[model samples]
Target: MSVHFKKKAANAQTAIPTASLPDIIFMLLIFFMVTTVLRETTVQVRTILPQAEAIEKIEQKRLVTYVYIGPKKLQNNQVGETAIQIDDALVDEVTNVRTIMYNKLTEQPRLIVSLRVDESSEMGKVIDVQQELREAGTLRINYSSKRDIEGTL
Candidate 1:
């Protein structure tokens, strides 16, 4: 019996299986969708920003912290007394601002506290908050204001 020797083909083409490509893509999309964070703070107080002739916009928003000061909006379209808001919570006591700001300062050393005070709000409260901020050693403050449309016109 004579046995025939067969030579294996050197140029064998191998293809990457893409059958699970769609499944892998779907899983990755779901993973990103689930992990992504949408950061929009629910503002408790209503702020009517005062118009300013000259206003400088903040470029690095991540380094800024907002403190909203305005009249508390009550039920039935009624407005209550002036209130201080930080993030989503209302400041129970003015003194607490110092500690809160100090903690925030530690977290971000270059923290810029942006005061979003309403037009009708009193300066005394603003000054009080400023004092508390000063006590906290957070001196970099930006008064958030809307640009004067009349000036542009």
Candidate 2:
């Protein structure tokens, strides 16, 4: 009689399991879709844009900052005195625009200030805002205006 010994080699897996890959990708996609926010601010000022002879569209909205200059909206659908609004807050002083715009410029280096002035608003307010923007070192500006329908017709 002879004694026999046998050795068994252990089997191991080298490839990564991709069985739950689709499930994980779908979960991540749903998470981002739910968490993302589009527009946050409610426009406090009313801006009935001025009509222009020629209008150019802005494709990159992220690079643009809107400055609203128009009559403040009061209760009972009444319009108050001419007011300046930056984002959601109403600007109190014209000189403060310099600091506000300077802060915005720091956040976005290539900031394009879009003046959405009301058709009825005075030029002096617009000029003041422009001067402040110049002091803030944000020279690239775009005046937002609607296309003239009467002229086209």
TM accuracy, model 1: 0.74
State the lDDT of candidate 2 residue by residue for 1-153, as single tens digits.
233455446678788999999999999999999777588677777789989887789877888998999999988998999999898899999999999999999999999999999988989999999999999999999999988888955
Off by over 4 Å in 1: 1-39
Pairs of colliding residues, candidate 2? none
Per-candidate RMSD, Å:
7.6, 9.2
Question: lDDT (CA) for every model shown?
Answer: 0.92, 0.90
Q: What lDDT tens digits, residue by residue, belong to model 1 across residues 14-133?
A: 988899999999999999997775787777777999999777989887899999999998888778899999988999899999999999999999999999999999999999999999
**Cα-based RMSD of candidate 2:** 9.2
Off by over 4 Å in 2: 1-37
- On lDDT, the leading prediction is 1
